[model samples]
Target: MRIVSLNAWGGRLHEPLMPYLVNVEADVLCLQEMVRTQGADADWLVYRDHGIELLQRANLFEELKAALPAYDAFFLPVARGDLFEGDRRFDSEFGLATFVRRTYPIIGQAAGFVHGEFSADGYGPHPRSRNAHCIRLFDYERGYPITIAHMHGLRDLEGKGDTPARRHQANALVDLIRQVKHEGDRLVVCGDFNLLPGSETFDILSSLGLADLVTSRGYEDTRTSHYKKQPRFADYMLVTSNVEVITFDPVAEPEVSDHRALLLDLK
Candidate 1:
């Protein structure tokens, strides 16, 4: 099975991002920073916060569902706010999405907030709400169940560091994992964790017997050229020892999004 995880940057790089999503051919795709605007006819919307403005695809989630018809789509929103086109305002949801191949029978699932609960109003303060989604599927070929869970970790304006909220988020993630994964299941957890390498999030995840594939495999940069920030790492993939990892790549080419895609091929 091939699984790919990316922070899609709200599909801001629409031209390159659409084709990449279709061509990647991942059995499972986990995307963060996904946007959905209901009843909005416009193709693009703008999100403004603290003077920073970002362009987002009006409904990238539904677009991907159409583009990848073979996958079962799931969207979990952490917050709902207003997106704009000129002076018109449209209600939009922001969060994580997971697409799994239809051939894989989804036998179990779980989802919950890792930071703050769903905010119906505007996206609350920085370190806005974040949620995680987990799905368990029986891989007939592998003759065992595989559990995959992903999340867009809380984004704190102060910086990515070990803090009480982040620690609570990590524990919440582990709790969600425990709720869905079975004893013999091969476990995989991934997403744009928004965390630095030395953060305690990994220590908490390690307690669940999963190992970080990015750092352990010597991937120093996970951000694309579009992101001109320091400490380029923001995405990661973790798998249990039982998973037979055929190949893993922190794809740097194609420039699909600001954050690099983490691709893992496993048996």
Candidate 2:
């Protein structure tokens, strides 16, 4: 199955869609930053043409049941900053969301946490950072696990570079794996994991056995740093040792949000 994972930055603008979503194809898509910032409703109709059903926010539980009967959603507590009303924190606040296709029903759900996973107060900043961070999708139908956690790096990792928070995040990921998964599961961790391969943050996932699909295979979606002048940041789509890595590429679409859409095709 060619499962595509992408973070739509936030629900602010149009997404960098893959050709499969538009044309005739059957595939699974995992999107982060699908937030409902405004009132009760969000701009969900945008994905209608994509031939996929988006899981609505938790508030619309009844609507989800009546409308799409196939999928349901679970929200994680995301930390928000007062500076930016909609902007989320690095390690705190916000929650993980899931949109599962019916071919595989969601027989169960879990959060990849082990108490003080980040340990914000124990490490660097007291408040810690949080965004639409990350999540793991558990498919009981297939008895496999797909992790959608966001390994995000900050704007300035230079000054606060040597702190333990970053390592804590990685360590927490390792611990999460032990808590939420078994050896037989096929793990795919994808999101805005800030640092690129070889960086400390990357090492966190890599050291734990998650391989970078972009570098391992040759799916260079677009130029890096989609948030910068050249868009060269390595917001990755990583996979575990079990799955066969196929293509890892970021869509060459214009920046809909700050980041571009990254993809990973696994076998």
The TM-scores, one per candidate, come to 0.99, 0.62
- Which lDDT tens digits does candidate 2 get at residues 6-47? 554443343333233333122344555444323333333221
Instruction: Please tell me which predicted candidate would have the highest lDDT against the true structure.
Output: 1
- How far out, in Å, is residue 74 in model 1? 0.6
Error of 2 at 165 (Å): 1.2
lDDT of 2 at 133: 31
Clashing residue pairs, backbone N/CA/C < 3 A, model 1:
none
Candidate 2 residue spans exceeding 4 A from truth: 15-29, 37-70, 80-96, 112-128, 131-162, 218-226
Supply every candidate's count of residue pairs whose N, Cα or C atoms clash at under 3 angstroms. 0, 28
TM-score of 2: 0.62
